[model samples]
Target: MAGETDPLATEQPPLSAGDLPAELPGELIAPEVAALEVPPELVAQSLGEYVRAWGARIRGGDPGVLPVILGLAIIAVLFQIVSPGNVFLSAGNLVNLFQQSAVFMVLGMAEIFVLLLGEIDLSTGYVAGLAGVIGVQLVQPVTTNFPWWVAIMAALLACAVIGAAQGTLVARLRLPSFVVTLGGNLIFNGVMLWALLFGPFSGYPTLGDQTNPHVLYQLMWGTIDPLIGWIILTALVVVVGGSFWLRDSRRRRSGLVAPPVSLTALKIVLIAVVGAAVVAICNINRAHFGTIEGVPWVILIVIGLLGLWTVLLQRTRFGRYIYAIGGNPEASRRAGINLVRVRTLAFVLCSMTAGLAGLLYVANQGGASNNFPGGQYVLYAVAAAVIGGTSLFGGRGRVLHGVLGGLVIGGINNGLYLLGLDVKVQFVVTGFVLLAAVTIDALSRRGASVGSVAHI
Candidate 1:
């Protein structure tokens, strides 16, 4: 054992080596060597290394978000070419597209929590519908008349209770998640229908029937002034982005592993570019009757949630537990993770997020009705998550994947509408795309499995 050389030490790398010190003549001769031997935190210590590492990953069955982005781009271009008058890319239409995308994006994100743990949630649609129903009902003038914030909290709390109940069934009783959530779907749907059809006010509760629409209306319809939007973007780019760079630089100086300086700068640049582009698009006058300029409040809500979820998943122990449990439940249990608590929390968070999506749906639709299309929404939520590059098998995804995937779904829907295509076409396209994504995921999993076996 003392004289034997590591097989890793002798194997060929995918590319020329990184700068990691070598133990032999060509030990670090491959860009992928670091990925194999170096610690995770330092995998991207250089821009070239990041590129090489990601390239290797893609080849090795993990494409990350690249496929989703490419799909979104291709869909955008295709729709732009076919849409009458090229209206798919029009400022007004794009703004409306983003608004329409909010629900799907949020719902996809909601599903990600459970999906990461190799689980599915069928009740999300009705949970969201119930949230909207409860929220709108609570704010009715002749009924509860609760403040908007209180109504929101109440709605989220209710969804959380439902999530906990279903999660308990799966986690504690060892019931199948599909059966548990399917039951929840029916239960919540019935409750929503009853509340809508037989409740105190009416079957349809609106935000502004003699009462103020309040923040509920504002969340979807309100806008940040163009100047203010620019200022906020600038502040975020300079302050938050600068803080990250400083922290990473300090880490490097202290002999700690940190992302390469160039990689960090490139990320900041990307943020600035995307933020600026969003503001520019939103600032364009998109109104037919009057100038409706400035970024929509819904955009901020979506972006804010994206940032929050990204941090929660990437930087927190809870996030790690989710992935660990999802990737290998047996190993995770052996590693001392409280499997029940984490899974329960995942479901709770998923439901609460769906509640938020419900409120947004109400905002966009102007009312909560019995015909919220919860079933269709469930399908779309799963489709968007899958299309966005979140693996169906679990332990591989980001919240941004949901957003980008939502964009693809929204884009295709909007583009088809512009082209006067039937609604069925949209569903057909989405279904085919979802199938392709699932196929890719399955193949990637197999590829990864093969690679692991070869190494072993």
Candidate 2:
């Protein structure tokens, strides 16, 4: 009686859906504040899901570098099919492509650091020439007889100073980058010409002899032994695969969503396959007398730099800040980002990279000429970055983009020459490609913005 009496008096009746409390004592709690979200594609739990998510992301605006890669493949096949000599895919021509792309790729990377910050450096081309001239002068026996490494540092330092000075004007004085770098372009070009004429050992139009600074230029042209190349490729595969696994595992352990294991494994396998193909291609005996050649040193340099820059941009805070600033400068400033410091550093990095590129240019050509066409080189660098899928409006790009774009440019140039086309046709084709890339970027960004608004 006592137990049943409370049913109509004080005992609680069974709760209905309408009578349920706002929250249940035993129910799972929904978060009041959501944590920062990552792209579902980046954290997919399966290969199929990853692909689906990636496709969705592409639809939303991040097309990545796949389009450029596909375009490059198509170009290669098309050129081979159309060329009478079938020289597009020839081993010698392929080697030449690697050599030719190195300077453009390096310069593109230089531009990328600034471009990501929504800035430009018109002076990089002449800056490179000036640095190369200084480096050559420092290493010449008649001038200083300094070691090549020392000359390299001094050259880079000079370029860094120039970049830092220009950066100061842009960042501190609030001057337009276009204006500052345009002035720098003119000044650096004049300085380059003067250095070529009066710097240390200069009598002929070219500073160095036929050897030109003693085997420095040969660095890009030299080949690693076939066995050594294979070994390096194997090591790279192992290291790369191991790294992916470790990084994913760490992320998972930290309670972060990570890429599916299968996807990571597939990436590793793909990379290994690509690396193997490159090594095999280079190992082909292309010499007339059946001499064995392997991967060129320039290829190694490019690969190394690509890896380094990719890590910097994807894994570092500085890189993240560059992107944030580019995406929304006002928001970044509000978030306490040191805009001036970051911008200055970006410029300095850009110039230093330009200096490195100049070294590569000299190495590839044996010497830097007074008529290095610095302005044209800068244009080419921009084209390479843009074609490789980087956006000109900033907030979207990567160093690898430049590398891929450089390949496309080099391919176009090489294919045209192989087909016996003149510079005029090449220029027209390249211009069209640049225009197409920009159009694609603009449309993609618009679509992404619309999608985001719709989601909101």
Each candidate structure's count of clashing pairs:
2, 0
For model 2, how does the per-residue alpha-carbon lDDT over 1-456 read when each residue is reduced to its tens digit?
A: 554441112222444567456755432231210111246536567988777767767766778897898989999999999978778888877888888888889988889988888888899999988888777777777657677778789999999999899999998899999999999999999998888775434522233543437656655767899999999999999998999999998988998878888888898999999999899999998788869589988888888988988888889878888899898877667566778878898899889988988888877776767768799888888888999988888888989999988889889988888888998998899899899899989998888777655544
After superposition, the stretches of candidate 1 with alpha carbons farther than 4 Å from their true spots are 1-41, 198-201, 209-212
Q: What is residue 181's positional error in candidate 2, in angstroms? A: 0.8
**lDDT tens readout by residue for model 1, 159-233:** 999889999988889898999999888999999988887455568878884444567878899999999999999
Off by over 4 Å in 2: 1-37, 199-212, 290-292
**CA lDDT of each prediction against the hidden true structure:** 0.85, 0.81
Query: Which run of 10 residues does model 1 get worst, by summed lDDT?
Result: 7-16
